[model samples]
Target: MKKNINITEEDRKIAAFAALAIVIHVLESSFPSPFPGIKPGLANIITLLVLFRYGWRFAAWVSLLRVTAGSLLLGTFMSPTFFLSLSGALASLLAMLLLWSSIRPWVGMAGISILASISHVMAQLLVAWWLFIPHRGILALTPILIATGIFFGLFNAIIASSIEKRLTDTV
Candidate 1:
C-alpha cells in the first residue's frame, strides 16, 4: 500500500517562493558590503510580501529554507554565519506571526515590516554578542543597528508594497 504525501498546490507555491528567496539570498551574499555587520537584506522583502499575500506558515517556510539553502550554497552551513542567519530569520518570523495574528486589522505591511526588521536585527545582535563577540563593547553598536533596522525596514516595506500592488493588479 502506498501512502499519499498530501502535497497540494500550496506546497508547490511555497516551494516556488522559497526558491526565489534562496536565489535572492545567494545573490545578495555576492555583493560587497561597505563594512562588516551590516546587510540591507533585500531578500526579506520577498518574505514580507509572501507573509501578507499568503500566510505566516508559507512565509516561515520560505524564510527558513532560504537561510538553510542559501548558507549551503555559500558554504557557510553549520558555521557562525549560518547561526546568525537562522537566528535572524526565526526572530523575524516570530515577530511577523505575532503581529499578523493579533493586530493585522490595525497594522499594515509597513508596521509588520518594521517590527520584523527590528526583531531580526536585535536577534542577530544578541546572537553575535552571545556566541561570537561576548563583550560589553558589543552593546555599543545597538543604537547603530537599530537605526539601520528602521531605515531598511521602511525601505523594504515600500518596495514590498509596490510589488504587492503589482502582483495584485496582474492577478
Candidate 2:
C-alpha cells in the first residue's frame, strides 16, 4: 500500500511538471517575435530542472506532455508546426539526458546547454524537411535557429542551475 501510494505521488509530480511546462510554453509563445519560431523556449527550463531532479524518463515525459498540450491549446493540433515542436523538444530532452548521465559531470552546464541547443535545432530542421519542406528549403533558417536555440538554452541552464541551488539549500 505504501509503495502504491508513493507511485501515485510520483505520477502526480510528473503531471504537475508537465502542466507547468505547458504553461511556460504558452506564455513564452505570447511574447512577440520578429520572426516565427524564435520562441524563448521558457518551458525548456522545466526540462533542465527535471533532468537534474528525476532523470531522463521524467524529463522526456514532461517534454512530451508540454509539446502535446501546448500544441492543442495553441491551435496547432496535428499540424506541421506541432510535429516540429515535438521533435525539437524530444531531441533537446534526449540530449539533456545524455549529458546529465554521461558528460555533464565532466563538461558541466554550459556544455550541456550548447549540445542540447544544437540537438533541438537539428531536430526541428529534420522535422521541417521531412514534413513541410521536402525540397529542403527550410534549411535556410538553420543558422538563425541554431543561434537562437543556443541563447535560449543558456538562459534555461542559468534558471535551472539557480533553482536547483535554491531547492538544494532549502532541503
Candidate 3:
C-alpha cells in the first residue's frame, strides 16, 4: 500500500534547516573536546534561530532531526551516546516550549538559550548517571557542566541574534 504524503513549503523549510543543523552536528562531533562530554554545541545555534523565526514546532523538528540523523551518521545510533543526545535535545525542547508559552514576551534569546542549555546538560548528566555510570562521582561534574552551559548558551544566543538581525535586514 502506497500513500501519498503532501509536503508543504513549511515542510521543505524544516528539512532544509534540519540538514544545516545535521551538518553542523557532524562537523562539531569531529572536533576535539577539552573534556569527555563537552562541546560548544554549535549546531544548537540553528535550532535557536529556527525557534525564534519559525516558532517552537519548527525548531523542535529541526533539533530532533539533527540529533537522530547526526547520530546515525556518526554510527552512534541506539548507543548510550545516542540516548544521551536524545535526552538532552528533548530536555532543551521542553525548556524552549515552556519559555515560549509562558514568558515569551518577557524573555529574550539569551535567557531562553541559557535555560535550554542548562536543561540539556542536566538531562544528559542524569541519564548518564542513572543508566551507565551509576556512580556519585558522575554528579561531581554538575558545576562544570552548568558553567559551560551558561557560557555557551550566551555565546550561541549572541551569534543567533546577530544572524537574526542580518536575516531581517536582508528581508
Candidate 4:
C-alpha cells in the first residue's frame, strides 16, 4: 500500500535545523572532555536560537531530533549514553516550556538557557544514579556539573543571541 505523506515547509525547516544540530552534536562528541559527562553542548545554541525565533515547539523538535539522530550516528542508540542524552534533552525541553509559558516576558535568553542547562545536568545525574551507578558518589558530581552548566549555558546563550541578531539583520 502506497500512501502519500504530505510534508509542510515547517517540517522541512525543522529537519534542516535538526540536521545542523546533529552535526554539532557529533562533532562535540568526538572531542575529549576532562570529565566523563562534560561537553560544551554547542549544539544547544541551535535550540536556543530556534526557540527565540520560532517557538518552544520548534525548538523541542530540533533538540529531540538532534539527540536521537546523533546517537544513531554515534552508534550509541539504546545504550546508556543514549538514555542519558535523551533524559537531558527532555529535561531541558520541559524547562524551556515552563519558562516560555510563565515568565517569558521577564526572562532573557541567558536566564532561560541557564535554567535549562541546570535542569539538563540534574536530570542526567538522576538518571545515571538510578539506572547505572546506584551510588552516592554519582551525586557528588552535582556541584561541578551545575557550575559547568551555568558557564556553558551563558556561553551558548551569548552565541545564540549573536546569531539571532545576524539573522534578523539579514532578514
- Tens digits of lDDT, candidate 1, 13-122: 88888888889899989889885777888889989988988899989999998999999999999999999989999999999999999988999888998889999989
Model 4 score (lDDT): 0.95
Candidate 4: lDDT of 140?
94
Q: On residues 1-171, what C-alpha lDDT tens digit does candidate 4 reach at each position?
A: 999999998899899999999999999999999888999899999999889988999999999999999999999999999999999999999999999999999998999999999999999999999999999998999999999999999999999998888885332
Model with the higher TM-score, candidate 2 or 4: 4
TM-score, predicted candidate 1 vs. hidden true structure: 0.94
Ranking the candidates on lDDT from highest down gives 3, 4, 1, 2
Candidate 1 Cα deviation (angstroms), residue 132: 1.3
Compared with the true structure, what per-residue lDDT tens digits does model 2 show for residues 1-171? 455445676688889989999999898878999988787777877877886688788888888999999999999979888888878888887887777777666865567777888898899898888877787568888899888878887887888788877876222
RMSD of every prediction = 1.6, 3.2, 1.3, 1.2
Clashing pairs in 3: none
Q: Note the clash tally of each candidate.
A: 0, 0, 0, 0
Q: After superposition, how far is residue 79 of candidate 1 from its true place, in Å?
A: 0.3
Which 10-residue window of candidate 2 scores lowest in summed lDDT? Answer: 1-10
Off by over 4 Å in 4: 169-171
- In terms of TM-score, which candidate is stronger, 2 or 3? 3
How do the predictions measure up, each by TM-score? 0.94, 0.87, 0.97, 0.97
Clashing pairs in 2: none
Put down candidate 3 lDDT per residue, 1-171, tens digits, no spaces.
999999998999899999999999999999999799988888999999999998999999999999999999999999999999999999999999999999999998999999999999999999999999999999999999999999999999999999988885222
Global lDDT scores for all candidate models: 0.90, 0.82, 0.95, 0.95
